[model samples]
Every structure is written in structure tokens, then in C-alpha cells.
Target: MIDPHHAPTGTAYATAPSIVQEICLIAEASGSGPSDVSGDREFRLRKAALLDCIAVQERARYGVAASADADDAAEVAAEWLVEYDVAHSGLSRKGRDLVLAEEYRDYVRAEYEAWSRSQAV
Candidate 1:
């Protein structure tokens, strides 16, 4: 099985693995962001990261975890990101209506796969 816990800390993914790790890293984000980000952006990212972690953790209480859980968590996190964009970037009405779940899911799946890939199983 792939172990996502020790995966590299990069999130730039071009594809996705069909299955996730035994544990989800998105649920474990420490929220201790990089020390370089010192501004409202950092706070906003932390808040969104909190949203992502909480939602994913909550999602785990249901039935067996599925790949879609990542999508669900990403969608929830995107809500906060959209709110920030609306307030700061002036997102269009169309933009406000959509949650960029795929992008965030890509991150989740990518992180999991990174650890999974490094494992022997």
C-alpha cells in the first residue's frame, strides 16, 4: 500500500491515482504554514486549509472512504477559496457559481499518490 505520510511536499500533479492512501493527508494539514507568507493571504490560506481539514475529517465518519471523498473535501474547501476570491479578486457571477473541486482534488490525490508511489506495495 502507498504511504502518503512521507510523500514529498510538492502538489503539482499532471494525473491522479485511482485509489488513496490508508490515511488522508488533507485531513492532517498542520496549518503551520510556510514562514514566508506574512499577510492576509497567509491567514486566508490557513482558514481555507482549516476548512479542508475539518471537512475531510468529518467526511471520514460516514461509510468506507472513497476517492470521491477527496472531491467532496475539495469542494468544501473551494467554498472558502471562492469567498476569498469574491472579496479580493472580484470573481464573476459565473465564477462564483462554480467550485474548483478538481484542482483541489488533484492536490489531495497527488499528495496521497506521492507517498503511495514511494512504497513497495
Candidate 2:
């Protein structure tokens, strides 16, 4: 139970990916065992943390896009990031309750690529 909110900002940002990986490990461990109350609770918490980490990564990347306004592409990318942040926030709190399925990831990736292409034009 790491409280991602209480973690130092730099440390939290740097370790987000690791946090997600840790959650995956927890999920794998629980998958191997029979269902238990405590395990279920742990899984839920880890999933929430994973979602928070993902949001943090997205925001960080968005910040980069916002700051790097060298041309129209960068500007469009920044706008896309803003829209993404708003839509994603509206969807779920740090995506905690939402399932992070492959389809969802693919959709986000597709949106990102489209944004990049828009910048190229």
C-alpha cells in the first residue's frame, strides 16, 4: 500500500511505470490462488494505484506536449492532450474503477497517433 498521493512528486512520477508493473504482479499472484477476501481487497487497491500511475504518466506527457510549442503540430498535440485529460478524468477517477482493457489502450494509442499526424500537417 503505497500512498501515491503522499509520495514526493518527483519520485512518484519517476516510479509510475514500476507501480503499474507491481500491480500486474499482484494480479498474477492472485490469479494463481483461490479467491480470498484479503486478496481481493489487495487486488482492488493495486488496480487503483495502477490507474493513478497511468494518469500521472499521461499528465506528464501532456505537460511536455504543452511546453514544446514549436509549431502547429505541437500546438495541436497540446490541445489533444487537454481534451484527453478532460475526457479521461470524466470517465473515471484516475481510471480506478474502469477496466484497462486492450481495446481501451488501443483507442488511446490511435487517438495519439492521429494527433501526431495532425501536427505533421
Candidate 3:
């Protein structure tokens, strides 16, 4: 896990929106977005998924023990929030590895399980 950072109380976040915009800009330019972004449905889906992933990552950050490590293993829920040097929060990097790691254990397991089920046919 990256070293957990803590900012002072009542931190101003004038730059947070820009930071989040930067993350979104990267994903948009990175070709990581959905295949069909020309419509509302796909856009909504991605946005919702982003929010959901962030929620899960936030839960993991709060719920995971500070002492947790790869060796300190146990099953727990996860979220996909991407923390940056500003504002201390954002779901700006939707499908990144750090985002995935914050998902604790279930997200990847669920994905693999889904894949396994698909392969069973």
C-alpha cells in the first residue's frame, strides 16, 4: 500500500476539481473509455460504474486496517477511489491498478469468478 497521507483539518480544495478533471482527461485521452461513448447509455454506465468503484475503494480505505498487507490477508469489501496530493479524493482514474488494489479483495475475485463462470459454458 502507498504510504497513507493525511492533510490538515479543513484543508482547502480549490485545486481538487482541476486534479479530478486531469484524471478524467487522462482516461479520455488514454482510450480506456467504453467502446461506444457516442451515446448517453454508455456514458451513464461508465459514470455510475466509476462512482460505484470509488465508493467501494473508500470503504476499503476506511475499513481496512492500517496494518493490512498482502500477507495480512482476509476477505473484505473494496472501493476504487484514486487519491492524489490534493483534495485527498477522486475517482478520476477509473480502471487503474491502484484503484483496483483499494478494492480490497472482492473486486478481482468477483471478476475472476465471473470469468470462470463464463469459461464453464
Q: CA shift at 4, candidate 2, in angstroms?
A: 7.9
Off by over 4 Å in 3: 1-39, 64-121
Worst 10 residues of 1 by lDDT: 13-22
Order of quality (lDDT)? 1, 2, 3
In lDDT terms, how accurate is model 1? 0.42
Q: Write the per-residue lDDT of candidate 3 for residues 1-121, one digit (tens) a residue.
A: 1112332111122112233563484368447565644233223323333333333344455654543442132222222212211123333344434344434333433433343355558
C-alpha root-mean-square deviation, candidate 3: 16.3
Clashes of each: 1, 1, 6
lDDT, candidate 1, 1-121, per-residue tens? 2122422223322222212321233223333466432234433343344344434444554433553555365566555555555677676536433535645433434433454455525
TM-score of each: 0.33, 0.33, 0.25
**Mind sharing the TM-score for model 2?**
0.33
- Residue 51's lDDT within candidate 2 is 48
At residue 75, give the lDDT of candidate 1.
66
* 9-121: candidate 2 lDDT, tens digit per residue: 22323322375476668678667766663324334333433443454444455754552333233233333433444464454424533233322433333343344355558
lDDT for predicted candidate 2 compared with the true structure: 0.41
| Candidate-wise lDDT, in order | 0.42, 0.41, 0.34
- Could you tell me how far off, in angstroms, the CA of residue 16 lies in candidate 2 after the best superposition? 8.2
Model 1 clashing residue pairs (backbone): 2-116
Error of 3 at 81 (Å): 20
